[model samples]
Target: MQSRRKLRFRLIVSFALFGFGLSALFAFAALNIRTRVEDQLVNASLMDDAKWANQQAREHPGAPSGSRLLTGTVLSDRTLYKAPLTWQSLENGVHDIFEPGPDGEEHHYKLAVYREGGIISFLQYDVSREELGKQQLLFSVIGAVFLFGLLSLAIGLWLSRKVLKPVSELANRLRDFRKAGKAEPLAPHFADDEVGELAHALDEYSARLTAMVERDREFNSDVSHELRTPLAVIASTTELLQGSPDLTEKLSERLKRIERASRQATELIEALLLLSRAERRGPTRGETTEVGKVAADVIESQRPQMRGKPLSIELAVNAPVSVNAPASVLSVALTNLIGNAIKYTLEGSVRVEVGDGRIEVIDTGPGIKPEDAERLFQRGVRGEGAGGSGAGLGLAIVRRLCELYGWDVSMRPRTDANGAIASIRFS
Candidate 1:
């Protein structure tokens, strides 16, 4: 997936860029106009100085004494020359040049040439001050651009916060609702705007969802209560039938099966109810239970399912182990694993090995697909090798039970054979 920029950051960057672009454009235009105006003014002044010096030469026919104008003349007769030796190669128009002045400082000058009455006059106007002024103006414009750019950034930040405050609040409220189960109503906290509408919608959706969850809990509780009564009656009746006098072996075996099925059904209901309650109220306290007893009960309860198949079930209790967890939860988790092993195995044995803090159900079933490893425990996701008789919820319930008790459950293929091993480790 591609990473995305946040809305607030994008907005602030856009405004800042806009500000910089406008400031740069204005600076460029201002500097260009000022340069053009200064060049024209300097050229006009040089032209006027050159023309007046030419008139002075025409009237006097010699050097104009005591004149402060930095002017020189070269007569065509070569009889009355007053121009510098460097002006001998001068052109007939204005030229801007840099030369050393009397004070030894490099100076910019506009040299203008005017010819009239067989005499050429050269006027040099020192424009170094004006050049420095123009530079100062350029610097001022650059400084203004930089200064206003910073101001624009500050303003952009302010505007972004002002505009995005409502959005931020809405986001905080959504996060708070997830963590704390309630948030202030957004519409009442903000103005009637688009963000307000989004907040209002979220608030309504949260309310509806909360109510729906409450209804679901109530329904599960009611169903569990309603189902337990008949299950208890069935269990008592099955026990009574098993104890009847003159009961045949065949009838006694069938009654035992019925009793096991009833108990399994009752335990299934209880597991589901406990799972639902745990989701709503968090995990309840656990009690110390004999792990071996739970494992044996689950294995015995699942034995009837293997009757018609060429498969065997074995229990390998290596050590006397115990765990701190709900006995029903442990039974359900083990039952799901053992049941799946028996249900899927075409032949061979389903082995339950009890070890320290763990139980491993190794089966000779077709090994699970490596591609389905991550998804096998998810609800409604059946591996390709899973038989079609189940809703794919057994492992999902097992996963939930493990989560509630902080246990670890894992399944992987057995590399030595065409089988899989499911392990549940208690923390």
Candidate 2:
């Protein structure tokens, strides 16, 4: 594909070629006019010379009373003329005279002499006026060609810009839609050309894309709703098994494991449901919610999960750090991030820092490898240190929620610390 600069250069070259073609046509017309004018002048000069020769023949005495012709020549120097000569050996029709003048000037003349009786006559005429007029015409043609060429160049530029304006606007709109991840359709302008066809096509494409996205959102929401029932039954069954008293010690231990697995599965299902909901809820409805308050609530709610673990919690939120997003969605996202930090950290603390339009969750567990950072938020991909206890959907859900709220998320190894730090910045 050609770059924009190359395309523009080609457009300019095309206009230049068009202008050159027009100039060539004008030059051809001028040349034709000059040739016709020269031909007419030559014919007129010949006729005038013939008339003078006939008149002189009538006035001349019967030197032979035959059709003898006298001819004269005018040279290139206007004041020079050759002596008249009677030619008896000439043909009876027309004859030409070539001679030198007084100043060695050279000229040519055609003489036509005829007679019924013996007669001699001469005709002298100058052909310089025709030559001079031809020179003037040639010079005028050259000047007009140059002037028209410049005029065509200017007009060509204006015409090119006028033709390319709609194309440029379409390109700009496509670029903006790609970068912003949403389309703003251009206002319609009607024309009976290819540009009009292109505009109609683009409008149809944007409409189809918008419809497809809306359908996908609706499908996700429906799927999430359908899965919730089964998840809830599994959670209730596991809880009932853990609470039953008829179980043996070993079986009770197994039941406790089942309960834990069921709880984790329930949390994973709930996270998926929340993620689907977040995706469907567009950004326009987000409200200002305090990040620090959400952080504190998540930490308090998850305190029971960290009962026997030697993990510390640190909150460094000083000022009111708020974000324009759904409070419930933000709470779920932050809870997942903090929970992942705690689950990954073996012994050290999990730190939650909140600032204006920013949140950071850092853990002092074994840091994630550089290669794994890219897929950390991808579904079903977990760090090497994450055991079978995690469903690997927590970070994915967090990332999805952040995206829905127009937030940027970055995860990397904490260089100054010992574990990974997940940062979220609100837009």
Candidate that scores best on lDDT: 1
Question: Which number leads on TM-score?
Answer: 1
lDDT digits (tens) for residues 76-188 of candidate 2 = 12222332435444544455566665568886555553333343333444455556776787787777767777776777677768878788877887898899987775546
lDDT scores for all predictions?
Answer: 0.81, 0.69
Local lDDT at 286 for model 1: 48
- Could you give me the TM-score of model 2 versus the true structure? 0.49
Q: Compared with the true structure, what per-residue lDDT tens digits does model 1 show for residues 232-257?
A: 99999999888889999999989988
Candidate 1 displacement at residue 282 in angstroms: 10
Q: Which stretches in model 1 have alpha-carbon errors above 4 Å? A: 1-25, 44-96, 103-105, 112-123, 149-186, 189-198, 279-286
TM per candidate:
0.80, 0.49
Question: Could you tell me the lDDT of residue 20 within candidate 1?
Answer: 83
Error of 2 at 202 (Å): 4.4
Backbone N/Cα/C clashes per model: 0, 5
RMSD of each: 4.2, 10.6
Question: Model 2, stretches more than 4 Å misplaced?
Answer: 1-13, 17-148, 154-211, 227-290, 300-310, 314-317, 355-357, 368-384, 388-396, 406-408
